[model samples]
Target: MAQDAKTLDLIAIGRSSVDLYGQQVGGRLEDMSSFAKYLGGSPTNTAAGGARLGLKTGLLTRVGADHMGRFIREQLEREGVNVAGVLSDPDRLTALVILGIRDRVNFPLIFYRENCADMALQPSDVDETWFAQAGAVLINGTHLSQPNVYETSLKAARAVKAAGGRVAFDIDYRPVLWGLTGKDAGENRFVENQDVTAKLQEVVALCDLIVGTEEEIHILGGTTDTIAALRAIRKGAPDALLVCKRGPDGCVAFPDAIPDTLDEGVSARGFKVEVFNVLGAGDAFMAGFLRGWLRNETVETCCEWGNACGAIVVSRHGCTPAMPTWVELEAFLSERERPFRLREDVELEHIHWASTRDRVYDELTVLAVDHRSQFLDLIAETGGDPERIPHFKTLALRAVRQVAGRDEARFGMLLDGRFGLDALAQAADHDYWIARPIELPKSRPLEFESSADVATELTEWPAGQVVKCLCFYHPDDEIALRERQERQLLRLFDACRKTRHELLLELILPAGMDSDSRTVARAIRRLYSLGIRPDWWKLEPLQDAVAWRETEMAINENDPLCRGVVLLGLSAPEAELLASFEVVAPFPIVKGFAVGRTIFYDVARDWLAGRIDDEAAVAALASKFKVLVDAWRRLRGAAEKAA
Candidate 1:
């Protein structure tokens, strides 16, 4: 079956089992004294954290088909976990872990997981369909210690990435699991314990993110101090975020440096909560980190959430039972704004490809409309190798047009009007096309005679069911006087009432003038009065906005409607900084812009007028467009990710 749409934001890929926790009532070890049985596992807890944080979460793990398995699945289900890919096998009872707390430390004992349900997990058990729907996939490092489970997890992680998802590896180092406790510290982990540091060391490099406790870090690095161990872990996951959970002292964070202006520091203990038990503290921290990481929170803030969630988990008795819900985390962060502000964004890596000289031409030929095709063929005849010519910039122009055609299905209609009543319906219910608007040199469309009584007709005008809308205003000309703009807004409001369809408005700010406080104030007032919201407002392009951070700030302050603004076609460092802003975010920015030259009006109308006959060329064009979209979307505001 296909993955559910309410698919989990975080998917834990590992063992799902039963954990029995018993505490010492005075000093005797009793299996039944205040014993608590709960569904527990590293991957399970991570999934729980994501679900509690209001994220659709799921789990893909192995568990016995007996009562223990049933119990684990039921427990996860209660936490809003999707169990579609949660495999159940009758071979072994669900893995069982018994933990006896002594002096605030955990001494956990486990039944062998060899050939067990979770350990029995095979590469055939999961697919890209499951991974593609998840925002992040968590893999247990301990599981990687075993050949079967370890190899299985590596395959799963690769599948997750192949499906366009992020992966987080939890280094839940269980020395006992590896039987390294009695062996000499210098002995090989694999030879002495059947599990080796060498294998784990290699797996460490494969993970996109790593989580480790101070002691685990010591075991991996053979260091006495946590900081030194952290440095060692950093070497393995230099590109991945290294999340180290300090026992009592608050967490430290490291967000990528964006040059000047960004002030980085370790987080302070935001809350002093009562401690209940420490067994699940690290797991809780991991859950919080996953939640914060998924939300795109800044480094320090992600740790802050981690610390808060960990504190709460430790304050409770049973494992996975102490996890706070998404609402609770949001409230916790709201109370501590210093480094706990919740934020999030999607992440993607960049790669520069080296292919053939005419690669661009070959790729773009796929998007050729009739005119573009004929024009391209002429160009090929004139400049391109009739057989093997290397066309440069001029060929690049045709390539760009071809690129646009390939995205025809996803093309959105962008109007230069003040209100995009018609565009929104088309994107959501119709084709997933986008509609944007160019800032008109005038206040509204040139078609408008003046900002006169167009209000009455607009108010009575029928509503549009489109999903995207574009609004244009000349910021430079300062035309469309505030009064006129306000009236123009009333017309938009009327148009909205005419339709029940959802729509996103793309308002284009004038190029020469990136921001106008007064203009923004006028637009906001009009929008608020109409009860209409703008999902995205394209302020000057990213390339143009970076140098004008002050303008962005001022405009945002004045325009409440820019709350959901997305700066499109951004190409500036400041644009990215603004995207990562704790309060303001430039989300889903339009990139890989496909526009025609002003000289092409005669032929541009037919840009979508053809079926590019070359299948390979068409696929290449589509792929290139997709690449551009991802690159452009990276322009975002500040975020909160863990260290």
Candidate 2:
């Protein structure tokens, strides 16, 4: 009678723990400088991965009343995984695993799961009614190794089976967790034991699908021979889908069932990727497999999906956090470039992490004064002397604070390094999100910072800051010109990676090249093909909702993880700029606006002309900035109300 109003694609029951990975690569765990915490554990990762792949997934596990436990729950919920069945254990603490990447193949891990909250899962925690609310239920091998949790898993499996739900067993057999190996047993690929084999076989007999590595299968089948193992597994569960994961070679699936003498099975080749970490590949594979199986896809397609997911997870670090989204996977599949491009090893990682970071743009209003050359010329004209430009930087920063003026609105600014590093630092000190420009204007071809090589200059810049770089881009530009510009942008993208700075690529289609929103969208796609995935795209405002939609589709198709678009005010009048906001209002992809002259031009001119003092200029600039901010907010408010 375990039925709920809502049903899920898959419900996974077992271990959920926190993985604290050492950040310093190629170093021993003890020598690593820092650790990055991510939600981990086999069942938890599978649930999170399923949700990432667009499955309605849920987790049934127990975590301690601690910070790590809270983090695990929150992260699962954030990924759209239902955690209604994830219970809290007040007595025991959450399990923890510390992992270190010594090399592509060497990942040293230490599991601290002795008497953990997940192990404290009792039979009472099993909600039999919930079994009716899932198409499939998955129970891990490690969960069956422990008595209390084993009983809990058994009850859940029985209830699921009784409710006509398919049960999938993942042989997540960890030797160390089973107390069959020492702490130094770097990889627990297999552990041969009579008791363990019997227990696993008991559950394997009940599963509609059985997934494990060769070693796991050998143990479950109670033999070292692969054929013998297949026969034994088939004897236990003749209708179970048997999948044997063959590492980088991909996997083979006996879709209907394994036979006594299996000669062939549906197979898929794995994607070739430079492995960064190999910890979460299996769980990621299972997630993909489930997504395909539940959709009733061909066994070969399911294996292909599984391999693709594993490839992505291994190319990055950590477990649940490293699992790719549907959009990311599609992009990864469609684009096939060499594993290593110039500076790709470093840049791709940064791009992956930056794009995956949660970007919530709920009425974000950004003030951009990151103008250069032609835009700066007007500032010089207003100020009467180009030499007074440095002072304008200070004025701009002061005006930023004035505009925000104690309001708790999410505000951002795009400043340039030419005369604005100090202002950048100031804005950062006040904790305002700031973006600094790296592009030098009007060079023979799009030039980056001139003072030093791209890498050297970026190294000196402050860490954790957003960099803004512009290019005079047009899709129809001569091939040579386009290539040159793209090369320069790639260098800038690499520089951003080395500096650990987020990039906001400001793209301007030269005054007229049959330009429309579609042209701009094409330019964005072209950059993505060249592997320039920026954190934000600063685009000129399009005229209508249709154009905006086209541009958004391009961004999604090219770089699904792109940090959305922001309208750039090209020194337009305030009224005209506000009009642009109205046009962009219907498009959620246009997160906010980064308008320079519209907000600060008049105030700068009045102040430089000796009409208004510094204080008065600050007030006027703040007022103008606030006016635009209020206007943008009003549009957003109206849109929300309409929706």
Candidate 3:
């Protein structure tokens, strides 16, 4: 079998095309939502995964010289797939598939390819030399269903096998692409007439490796038990690797040797995870196996790595979006005990803004002090779940797990009252965030001139890291009644410039002045004119009367910069104002917004001016989360250092 010129890890020969994916709205499959495009094809996705895992991978397909074809080529190239054998057909258009993600279990793909160039691949496209070169060759059964390319693939596979290069076959069974035979009343009908599922079983015998999903196994299983399937496969090609992908449960691998019993063969479980889109998780797992195979790892190890790769791939929204980077993958494998964390953390707290909840808290713990009616309202109104607690860690844990969990693999975090380089370094390992309240100086609230200096200090903190800023608009300021507070606005801008560095701005406005006050309108126009781009601008234009129409009119009154409005600042009666928004602005306007100076300016500022101890601040956290005039001396110490 040692006849090849040189050894190569893997070579894949198959039909490649761009699959334009769309999502299903509600429960309707045909009634689709807006569509999105990606460079997707069965073998192409597998090759892309292999290349991403640092494997030397290649694709052999005949694609037309068209936009979709070019897109596929670029996508593969970006993934670093060797495209030396990928040929171009000038006459035909590249193949395209309209893919629908109905649910995690169902994907209905509509192929728009008729006599696509990829299926036109002939035996003469290349000598058996290319097949003879690789350590393993992957042949998608799609091309093999076509006569010319089908015969060519079989022959090249034989040659590669004879040359000691292993053959791996992906029975990428597509019904629409197969059933059609010809245009003028030929013995056509791709999927209808042919027993391709059986034909693929024949190739599986010859294949050194056979990879497919459980559905595929069921299609070709032929009423056979797992033992009987192996026996049947062994009848044709006795010594080859047989694998089945089982999504989150990982995959099963049985190398060339099939024992007399199913229990005797290799059987291993997979990594567990919650899934999102899951369309290409199989291909990614294949790439994982191929990479491990290339490294000459043990068969068990190869299967384990495949399981790991598939687990990560399926947990996210898209095929490519959550692909584990190389360094991260290594770290994931290396860091055994630590749980998986998201790239960033968001903080939420049991803030003492709820008057009613405070009463409930007196009788019950924070966790048990449930708003039974509001939770019911949350579910009934917006379809959000109610049983769960409303904290950043709770929400984040549920989101990452894609389910309510007691599982340890998924994680969520809350602040432990820490900061700076060491905390940040430690935070890099944390997956979720806690609403860590940062206070201003009690002696003086933050001013614009001092903002830049604060920003300069943040420059040394971290790069591309997010810091939440907080501030408020004064209700007693002259801007509400007479005219715009020019000096105040200017100071706000200066603070904005400074805090944009290390701080995140939480623009708090008065519950009363949240309306289309001409003063507020003029101020907004001024900010627009001066080109002052704030991270967020809270729109709190509420009217005295609690009508949806009043709230609608207030929100609709055309401000110069419509998109600039970040949060819809509102209070209790203004709560119905959320319903008034015809189109909920890009951001959400939540209730129970409590500020420091606005609420606990006296005690907190006293604490910040070194009037209280850490014990007292801890006590404050129990009572409420308030916007005092400044933060405790704890943060002020850092501020002075930064100064």
Alpha carbon lDDT of each predicted model: 0.52, 0.80, 0.51
lDDT of 3 by residue, 1-643 (tens): 4524454567788767776666442344467765656666677777777776776778788788987787678667766778877889998888776666566566556766678878788888856777677677788867777678877788778877788777887766555555553322211112333276576766776777777665555445543255565556656666767777766656767776667654454655565555555666777777778887767788887887777777766654446433554544564465454323322111100010011010110000010111123234434654543332233123222222332133321222222123223333444543322122232422123333233454444434333233333334443445443123344344444543333321223344444655443444444344444433333334442342233233234333432112223223232232243332322221122111222222222333344345665455444533432111112222334434655
In what order do the candidates fall by lDDT, top score first?
2, 1, 3
Better of 1 and 2 by TM-score: 2
- Ranked by TM-score, the better of candidates 2 and 3 is 2
lDDT of 2 by residue, 271-294 (tens): 877777889989999999998987
Q: What lDDT, from 0 to 1, does candidate 3 have?
A: 0.51
For each of the candidates, the C-alpha root-mean-square deviation to the true structure, in angstroms, is: 20.2, 7.0, 22.3
Candidates in order, TM-scores: namely: 0.48, 0.71, 0.51
- Candidate 2 to truth, TM: 0.71
The residue pairs in collision within model 2 are 2-128, 2-129, 3-129
Model 2 spans > 4 angstroms off: 1-6, 23-31, 88-92, 103-105, 255-257, 260-262, 269-276, 328-364, 367-492, 495-502, 507-531, 539-563, 568-573, 582-589, 595-643
Estimate the overall C-alpha local distance difference test score of candidate 2. Answer: 0.80
